[model samples]
Target: MEKSIIIGLDIGTTSVKAVAFSRGGRVIGEQEIAYPLSTPFPGWAEQDPLEIEAATITVIRNLIQLPTIDEKNILAIGLSTAMHSLICMAENGEPLSPSITWADGRASLQANRLRVEHNHIYDLTGTPIHPMSPLVKLIWMKENNYLPYQQASYFVSIKEFILYRWFGCQSVDYAVASATGLLDLHHLKWNKEALELAGVSEAQLFKPVSPTEVLVDLDKTIADQIGLPVHIPFVIGSSDGPLANIGLGAINPGEVAITIGTSGAIRQIVTEPKSDSLQQTFCYGITESLSLIGGPTNNGGIVLQWLKETLDIKETYEELISVAEKAEPGAEGLLFLPYLNGERAPIWNANVRASLFGLSLRHKKEHIVRAGLEGVIYSVFHVGQALERLAGKPTTLLASGGFGRSPLWLQITADVFNQEVQVPISHQSSAWGAAWMALFAIGEVTDLASIKQAIPMQENYMPNPDHHKIYMDLFKLYQELSHTTHSIYMK
Candidate 1:
């Protein structure tokens, strides 16, 4: 008796991963292929699309070849890609420029300009006026007369480019399109004014499709390269953010998903399109009837990495965290503003820099390490605050990502947000969500709600009563210091 398996392919900023899962939601095998993100100039983060495509094919091939994986029993493969990657494409499907990722800040000037005059677009599209938005990126290209922009026949995301190369079609899932700042959330189509604003037309973008849309008949060459049948169906899963919520089984009412990887986000599923008046959050479509409202922070685990390197700490991450756990809450009045990588959501400013305030001679290596970790979770809490403002308070806070591996990190998150945080047995939420989407697309699963039952969970991290009060008081100082720092950049 062969076990049925499905593979989920995640196209992330710096790597591509394929995870094989059994029908029961247990992992069968997995493989990951890494690539480099080139920064030719300041504020420019780009990747060679062709190189990424090679990695993608290699990762899938390697995953299928794992001893535990029976390619013959493979049912389907689904996609979950990071959002806001823009690539200029030629008429013949070749890339005119490298894929500009979400971290690129080259469009900060243009984004700031648009933020003043055309702010209404945020209400219409549900994406903030940030450099991460492809629309803002396009505006920068158009204004500066970038050569690639002039030569491009079409604009597409990395996922769409891969699909075009494999399937010879220019198609984008609704969730990725909504993050572009060019899709009409209410109408679920490319916005005419947004196109006119970016100096591109509807003809220049990929045809928007539902996330559950099935793409079949993989290119025969690619199919042979991966040793899979050409007719195997591929479900067009949503962006990593929305799919992560599904992966963590956080779609039920009052459940919010918080993921902290290299970056972080806090998202909640909503019945209809919702946007905050302050433009603090984005609403990306998941299905025709459902959407995800959330905010993303550019800083997360990267801040801790930066701190560890700056202090010349040679200890492993686990050891450093163990030392940090010794420090009491508040780190004895040492607070850090984790804007080392600029910022997104709530602030929407890319010029803001990092700062360590309230530093005193009493602070030691452990205190600094603890404050650094606290600062990272505080950044997540900052985004969660904006999420709450838009979608109201969450009853359950679900935590995922690299930070979740540390009990101290989860406890800090639970304390700062003053909510119980549930950790899933598997940290591969995006990949799992993509696998579930493949099941739903093939009619093997009844509905999205059924995934909640398949996922295994551990005991919840409850908020500490004593620590919560200290954090709340310290959070006010964090809020004040954040505003002061942002004001300096804005002025």
Candidate 2:
């Protein structure tokens, strides 16, 4: 029998990565292609769509060229993309403008206007009003400079744009649409009320499909160029955040995952369609039976990266965590507010900037590093508290991604959140989760729980009772600092 291969492509902030898994699910090939984020202005972040598309092509071609995997047996390709990027294009699928990332805060005024003027946008889109969201960004564009958008035949996300190039299809997944802040979560379609208010129409958009089902076939020209079989099947996938939950085995209600990658998020799956009464976060459909009611924060691994570069600490993250561990709990007095790109969830404030309060001559790099990790963990704790409040109880934390590589940070998170966290023995949950869904989609996996047998346990870190008490007091201080510093962020 010939072996089968499945490839999962993750379009991320820094680069496009592709991973190939064999029929037995062994990782056979992997590659990453770097790309730059265009920042023409202080708060604006954009990317040329053609450059991203070309990078994707190059990475996939590079992956298939690896000697280990036979290219022809590649059965399916699953796409997992960064959520909430807005792209405008012409009728012929040419880009009208650079894609605006979810981190772009140019639309703060638009978001404020919508939130103040119209009270029910949250009830419809579940996503909170923030400049980082695609909806507000679109509003800012239309109201400020309508010429570009007026010329745009279609406005879609990064994933949909890739699909249009690959399959010549003009559609996106419901899971993607759910995060766009324009789709009414309950209706599973675009919010016409928002459209009417924004001076756009549903007719000017693309179709939203299920993340698990195959939508269209890859074009022969593109497939042959990448060494895959022409007309191979491909399925649209959920956002990287929701997929991270699946990848980490956080598939059921109240089973949550905190991922710290280039970005950070706190997500949990819910069985019923639920919204935060406080409008703190967004809900996305993981599958028809399961829904993801969680908050995504813009701060996390990025903060650590910035700290490393700024401090000129050339050590790997492992060494950095070691440095952080040696520092006293609470970093003594320093509190680093990680808002390098702006923040989301719990405190959806994009006007904020990164600041270190309580910095003193007594503190050193170790203190700041420790405080940065604690800061991110505390931020994750805030999301957990928000989810707990909405869901009526606490959820288990199953962590994944770059932070998953560090033992000290994991223990710190446990102590800070006062919850035991499970670290899966298997890495690459994103790729594995996508592979599991593909298998389920094709009927190879009979039940979702059956795959749990394959998931190996790594280490479970318990909260330190002694440290927890100390951090509780510091958390109160942290909370106070957060509230006190909000007004001064832009300054």
TM-score, prediction 1: 0.98
Taking all chains together, each candidate's TM-score versus the true structure is: 0.98, 0.95
**Superposed model 1: Cα runs more than 4 Å off:** 1-3
lDDT of prediction 1: 0.90
Tens-digit lDDT track for model 1 on 350-434?
9899988888888898898899889888877887888877777899999887887989999999899888999987788899899
| C-alpha RMSD by candidate, in order | 1.2, 2.0
lDDT of each: 0.90, 0.79
Query: 120-226 in candidate 2: lDDT tens per residue?
Result: 88877777888877888888988887576879888888888888877888777777787777787786888888877766778777877777777556787877777
Write down the RMSD of candidate 1 (Cα, Å).
1.2
Error of 1 at 337 (Å): 0.4
Give the clashing pairs for model 1. none
| Candidate 2: regions farther than 4 A off | 22-26, 487-491
